[model samples]
Target: MSPKPSRGTTRTTQYQGNPRRILVGITGGSGVIYGVRLLEVLQQKEKDGIETHLIISPAAAITIKAETDYSSRYVEKLATKVYRFGNIAAPLASGSFRFDSMIIVPTSMHTLGAIASGVSDNLIVRAAEVALKEKHRLILVPRETPLTLIHLQNMVRAAEAGAIILPAMPAFYEKPKSIDDIVDHLVGKILDLLEIENALFKRWEGLSYS
Candidate 1:
């Protein structure tokens, strides 16, 4: 088990300067599109020196094929670096391997429970553990509906341990016309958390009430 962080520990580094490194983990959740779109958006921001290190879980490969038209190889090409799910020896497993933040988009309930319990059985969870222990930003984008009490409790546990629980719920206040619009809104929210400027989706300009 990874060591827990102490209360009120400050972040080791900020997302300043060029070449901001971000670690992205895509699990087997149904909304793999969010993960893929995040990569696409980050790839577009490569000129801004946003470097992405990606990890695709074994189950995520199956989800990608079942959900999206793009091949897994194609998805890997969007990231600056890619690692296998089972590679515990990867540099990301170490807290010394510096990164600005870690985002696990479409975070599976199983993954949530594992991270909440500090069970680093695989590279993704290990990397997330490093983020938490190192006091770096860790964002989890859970995509399940009708969440069970256990699921909610795990989320609370992870949150208490310094993880940001960002769900995959899309808002209708934007009046999105297509699925891409909805996905972009959530991806844009992720970018907002990263403090990266983007206009992927329109911001909520207050409505006029007559």
Candidate 2:
């Protein structure tokens, strides 16, 4: 568990020449690997002075165990800070918390509906609300197949509310060789949206059909 922040106290990231602070949220979605890979890349960025704050839903813990070999404990260790899902008092639950952006990897439909309806029942939802109100970057990576009209409508609503709805759709143009390649492609796109530099996947070049 990460250390708790004092009530109403401002939490600041390491201010060593414009370091990027990111907030990541993981929910009970099928593509838990997406969240795992994202953390791995962010951990590497620590050398560059980037700081990451993570929040994992209880359902996400079960999904992570079922979907991957890694334990939730290991995943938490990858982040610079971890906040309890129900800890609405966490610094990240406020707009005053200095972070560049927030990304919800494997954003479950339930979370999506909640955020779209302006519900802030939990820390993750509260943090996302703070991001939107503060006009900070907010990315949602939903991971569900056969999205229903309700899901699509929620996505549109979130987008209209200034949230980037980036679904976990990997492109085949990159000719991925392994599962990691595909995973990196999605993560790379997420990084791009965050304006973070990464060479995790091959970029598209001009092509000709002759």
Write down the worst ten-residue block by lDDT for model 1. Answer: 5-14
- What TM value does model 1 have? 0.93
- Winner by lDDT: 1
Candidate 1: tens digits of C-alpha lDDT, residues 1-210: 544634422343445575889999999999999999999999998887889999999889999999999899999999999999999999999978978889999899989999999999999999999998888889999978899999998988888888888999989998999999999999999888888889999988899999
Q: What RMSD value applies to candidate 1?
A: 3.3
lDDT by residue (115-168, candidate 2, tens digit) is 989999999999998887777788899989999999998988787777888899
RMSD of 2: 7.6
Cα TM-score of candidate 2: 0.90
C-alpha TM-score for every candidate:
0.93, 0.90
